[model samples]
Target: MASFGIIGSKGRMGQALASAVEEAGHTLAGGVDAGELPGPLALQADVLIDFSAPAALEANLKVARVAGVPILIGTTGLDDTNFAAIKDAAKAIPVLQTGNTSLGVTLLSALVKQAAERLGDDWDIEVLEMHHRHKVDAPSGTAKLLGEAAARGRGVYLEEKMESGRHGQTGARKSGDIGFATLRGGSVAGDHSVIFAGEQERLTLSHSAENRTIFARGAVRGAEWLIGKPQGRYTMEDVLDL
Candidate 1:
C-alpha cells in the first residue's frame, strides 16, 4: 500500500481523505494545512493528494516536484494561471487534476459526452449544479467540466459557447449554446444535472453526492493509481479507465 500525504489537512475534504486512506488499507504519511509547510510531508509520501484552495496549488506542486512524488489535485475554482502552473509541474512529475474525484462523476462525464454526441445540437443543453452554501465558487468546477464534455461532443469549444448566469431580458436560449445554472444553499454535498431539451422529449443525466466520503475514496484510489506513472497530466478517467 502506498503512503498518502494530504495538502489540505485540516479541511473537510482532507479529513475525509485521511479516513479513506485508512479504509483503503493505506498509510497516511502525514498532512499540512495552509500555514504549514508541505515540503516535509511531500517527502514522506509515496503519493500526494491535494484538496486545498486554488491559491495553494503552486506551492503544493512545487513541494511535490521537489519530493519527486506524483500528486492528484482535486481543488476547484482554478483559472488560466493555475492551469499553466499545473502544466509546468506535469513536465517534471505526474499530475492528475479534476473538478470532482467521485467515481460516479467520472462515469457521468463519459455518459454526458456520449449523449451529447448522439443527441445533436438541436437539443438545447443546460447544466445545473448545486453545492453547500459555504461553497465559494459559482457554476462549480464540476459544472464547467460537464459543459466541456458537452462541448467536446458537439465539436465546439466551451469557452466560446458557454452561457452562464442569465439575468433579466436575456434573449431566448440560443441553439448549440451550452447553458449553466448554479444553486447554493443548505448542506448539499453536491448535485449536478445535464438537461437536453428537445422539441418533444427531454433527457437528463445527473449525479448526487451524499457525502464527502465518495470524493475521499476516489482520491485515495487515484493516488494509488498514480504512484509510478510517468511525468504527465492525467484525469480521473485515466484512474478509473472510463
Candidate 2:
C-alpha cells in the first residue's frame, strides 16, 4: 500500500482525503495544515496529496520535491504564481493538479468538449455551477474546467472568450463567447451544467456531486496513479486515459 500524506489536514476535504486513504487500503503517512510544516510528512509518504490553500502550495511542492515523491494537488482557486510553481516543481517530481477530482466530472468535461466540437457556434454556450455557501470562489473551479473543455473544442482559449458575473448594462451576449453563471446556497455538494442553446433546440451536459466521497475516492485513486511516474505534470484527463 502506498503511504499518503495530506497537506490540509484540518479542512473538510482534508478529513475526507484521510478517510479515503484508509478506505482505499493505503497508509496515511501523516498530515499537516496551516502553520505546520509538510517536511516530515513528505518524508514519510510515498506520495503527497495537497488540498491546502493556494498560499501554501509552493511550500508543499518544495517538500514533495525534496522528498522525491509525486504529489496530487486538489486545491482550488489557484493563481498564476501557484501554477508557475507547480510547473517548476513538476520538473523534479510528478504533479497532478485538477479543478475537480470526481471521475464523473472528468468524463463530463470530455463529453462537453465533444458536444461543443460537433455543434456550431450559432449555439450559445453557458456554464452553470452551484456549490455550498462556504465556498470562497465564484463560478467554482469545476465550472471553469468544463468551460475550458468547451473552449478547447472550439479552438479558443477560455479567458479570451469567457464572460461571467453579469450585472446591469451587460447588453448582448457575444456570439463566440462562453458564459458562466454561479449559484451558492445550502449544503449542495456541487452541480454543474453546460448548456448549448441553439435557435430551436438546446443540449445540456451536466454532473451532480451527491457527496464529497466521490471526489475523495477519485483523488485517492489519482494519488495511487501518480506514484512511480516520470517527472511531469498531470491532470484528471490523464486519469480518464488510465
Which candidate has the highest lDDT of all? Answer: 1
Q: After superposition, how far is residue 188 of candidate 2 from its true place, in Å?
A: 0.6
Model 2 worst lDDT run, 10 consecutive residues: 233-242
Give the per-residue lDDT of model 2 (tens digit) for 47-163: 999988999999989988999999999899998999999999999999999999999999999999999999998999999999999999987889999999999999999999999
RMSD of each: 0.7, 0.9
Candidate 2: pairs in clash: none
lDDT, candidate 1, 163-185, per-residue tens: 99699999888778999999999
Off by over 4 Å in 1: none
Model 2 stretches astray by more than 4 angstroms: none
